[model samples]
Target: MLQEVAGIRIPDTQLAKDAADILREHGDNLLWNHSNRVFLFGAVNVRKTKQHYDLELLYVSALFHDLGLTKKFNSPDLRFEVDGANAARSFLQQYQIPDESIRLVWDAIALHTTPGVAEHKEPEVALLFSGVGLDVMGDGFEQFPADYREEIIKAFPRNNFKRDIIPAFYEGFKHKPETTFGNMKEDIVKHFRPNYKNKNFCDCILHSPWTE
Candidate 1:
């Protein structure tokens, strides 16, 4: 609902508006609101760090970061992250966006859950991941002023995010359980599918065919 927060204004370009509409059409309200918060929180961090980034790129990445979780975008065999990334790539290509810019948004969405890696990428990528972390896990939460945090939430109310987000996550990847392997998403699978057994990396190595 907020067009501007902490000196950062939502990109009002037609492309950004279209992107928001696409997310709204395909994603539920939780994701719709969460995506906006991601951009706002990411923007705030950009200012805090005194770093320059393409607002449009960051905005698109934030908006589509959870898109893979939506019913329309979820895939049978791909990681939800990849599904989201591919959706963003296709949308950007439609506007004749350059490959480089598309790649940045794609990577930001795909690597957002990968923790150690995303934090070191391009500013857009790193900041998007940071924003998601702050929103979901409260990572680095203490750094943001309480009033600013209040403003962000007031703009996009969490509305039981603590409990709702779990089901939101589970439903996204539940059908593609194998895709969650070797990632934090495996935990989600295990939580919901009590009998779920994660594929062991060590087991894979031991079973792998080799002459050695």
Candidate 2:
């Protein structure tokens, strides 16, 4: 079934792809598919970014990042940073992926939840963003409940949070404190949203602000 679905000729040794097949619970939650597509596009840009590596490394990293999702869900105690990287390492060792490639895979897994780690860098940062960051926010990140959906305005590095996590959770929501929530409210209501009468700079969304 997986061979028919994936339409590729891979051996039994490559459990990552098989893992992907096992993990596709919903059509929309096909994180692995999204990840694969992101890697396909991201790698094109990675090739142009002047980072030294073979194609193999990118493939290994891209495939490895999502390994812990099901494992985490089945036994919810697993932290993404701990369980995800360990799962990736186990697979990489089985595939005989080199040490350097394994490191990239580990880094990719570690920081997929926290983009700020790769924020300023190219390829590495964008690869992680394209792979999971964008999906974690959905098209607008507005589908989440009001308490958990908020803007990302934190300054980089130390103060920055995992901007995409809260906005896309199906359940197990986390709410930011007042200062954080108020800042997000300002960003959405003041900066992103506008008064209905102010037509000059406002987007079409607020054109008839109260009438929607």
Candidate 3:
């Protein structure tokens, strides 16, 4: 049965259930719980705001947004966010979902980690980021009704998220340091991988291979 919090429905379609199963297979308990919370929080926000969005797409986006952080989906070259996005694209393609809907999910997963920009994109994309921010950093968290917030958290306990999530982030991005350039993912490398050095932008400009 689909669960509801604050009048928003949690998707329980077979596709949604299959997606959850995939996450359970590849992700740890912390990630699985966090992903579920992201969906719930996003759904609650959308309902409270009275915005229209494809609930199934939003659920898939939230569930797949962090797949790159799992061993099964981690990429050696792409940013973890992009890795997750590509994985979503490939997965959705199997179901023959419409290209337009697939693109929205792709964008939602790809840009979920980016701040200040995602909230202005498509509604699904915006809500996905909102949920991520709420769950990960407490952004907009206090605005939600306390009882609803408690319901979401109780359904999906955080499980020492603050201490455990960093390692998962590091594991996903450590091998793709270059992909982190110009984004917050770089911060992960800078903090966790001590020897990982960021390429200086000014230095690259001065040493450009092309000189007019």
Candidate 4:
């Protein structure tokens, strides 16, 4: 059965189901609920803004956006967002999804953590970022209708998300602190990992081996 929240219908295709199953298998209760909320919030934004988006593609992006935070998907040298995006790309390829759609989904997941720029991308990419922002940081929360927000939260209660999600972020980034040097993920490493040092980008460039 397709679930509808805030008048947006969740896709019920086999690919959608498979994506959900993969998430359920690897994601904890908090991660699963958060993923669903991301989808719902993104859907609501699409409807409220009267934006044209590929709903199924957005659904897949939302579901897989946080996979890199899971133990099953974590990588030692890539940003968690990139790990999650790569996982989504690999999954979609198995089903023969077109290259263009796969790229959109990849960008949507990879750039969900990036602000200002994501909103300028395709509708699905923009909506994914909007949804993630609303769920993770309450950005634009006031723009959503009250009853609709309530319904979405009821369906996927946050369950003390503020306390829980930070550790997940730390765990995902701690292994690849170098990769987060210029991005928001570096903040997590700086705060949680004791004595962690960030490699300065300018210093690296100045000391480059390419000196002629």
Candidate 5:
């Protein structure tokens, strides 16, 4: 938890406090949170060390990067970086945050997702992206054959990102258990009944683990 000093100016004190509470509630000494906590400190510490001019705006932006995930929006896809950016913009406007800081907050929030792009522009954005990914990607990660990626993309909503979102990352870490037969729900199971060859299922059971 980085505190605002005499020179630090955090407009919404409650946003700062709520962010702290979210971290404590969800954190469990995980390296992701620990490093994030350090990143927060380092970003702010830059002011003291090098007299960085954007420390306050940077810190405030970092603090609310994930604010969209709050209870305000429950849809799975709505918790993403772009959604979070929109939420930040609205929150700042509601709180009457200065126009000068609005751009800083929006930039950080938008860049938080596309780490590849932020690599050169906003290095700190990449840091925060990793911080959030290290945790979010763990919960819903998954993987499938190359051919299945497009199928997954078609199966989910545009923003849902079945093939690239947090779900895909976590799923990639582990194979599905053998007990669950069929391609997901009952639809795919019945769709391929005409073939009756069962090549897909056989290949899945044979090539996939847990076949013993």
Candidate 6:
């Protein structure tokens, strides 16, 4: 009973279903819906450009990309992105998926939050990054058809996303502020935890062991 939205077929393989079920169990309604939308949006991009891609990998990557933000998957020391990426790597390993495919999923999840870089990687990585950007920030929003956008939203309502997603980001990694260094996520930490201090690149350079 796989459904198509905007002419993109949802992957129905066992691997896809298993990944979806795991995410559904661990993630809240907002996250679950958002993840599903990411997969569809990524697939739609590939279809729109008539580019060849591995749909199942895209689906799995999208499903697992934000998983590190969940309580069950959050780790104490690693970046949330790496946490999610490692989770995908371990899951794919169990199925004996090829190392190269696992690597793509890992990179896609790890770099999805990074601008200017993910877009230059393999198609799956780039598409996942764009898909997330489109859903969260409306990047490339105009390229999608109006009716298709309406349909996608209907299937996965984004109720109060603008107001709620910030809190979601804060709660996900507030406990691991150190991991936010070198990324925009530090802004989230700074906003909510006012007393929190972010690492400064210039400060590190000036205070290094070398004295001029």
Considering lDDT, which of the candidate structures 3 and 4 is the better prediction for this target?
4
Query: Per-residue lDDT of 59-156 in model 1, one digit per residue for the tens?
Result: 99999999999889998999999999999999999999999999999999999999989999999999999999999999889998788788889888
Give the alpha-carbon lDDT of every model.
0.91, 0.43, 0.87, 0.89, 0.43, 0.88
Query: Taking the tens digit of each residue's C-alpha lDDT, what string does model 4 give over 1-212?
Result: 44787787889999999999999999988888899899989888887678777999999999999999888888888888998999999999999999999999999999999988998999989999999999988999888888999998888889999999988888777767898877887777878876887888889889999965
lDDT of 6 by residue, 73-181 (tens): 8998889999999999999999989999999999999999999999999999999998999999999899977787888888878998888888898888988899999
On lDDT, the candidate that comes out on top is 1
User: Compared with the true structure, what per-residue lDDT tens digits does model 5 show for residues 69-99?
Assistant: 4344212443234555676577667667787
- Relative to the unseen true structure, what is the C-alpha lDDT of residue 170 in candidate 6, on a scale of 0 to 100? 84
What is the full ranking by TM-score, best candidate first? 1, 6, 4, 3, 2, 5
Where in model 4 is the C-alpha error above 4 Å?
Answer: 210-212
lDDT score, candidate 6: 0.88
TM-score of each: 0.97, 0.47, 0.93, 0.94, 0.42, 0.95
Cα lDDT, model 5, residue 167: 34
Q: Report the poorest 10 consecutive residues by lDDT, candidate 2.
A: 149-158
Model 3 over residues 58-105: C-alpha lDDT tens digits?
Answer: 999998999988888887788888888999999999898999999999
lDDT (Cα, 0-100) at 64 in candidate 4? 95
Q: How close is candidate 2 to the true structure, as a TM-score?
A: 0.47
Clashing pairs in 1: none
Tell me how many residue pairs clash in candidate 6: 0
Q: What residue runs in model 5 are displaced by over 4 Å at the alpha carbon?
A: 1-15, 18-53, 74-79, 122-212
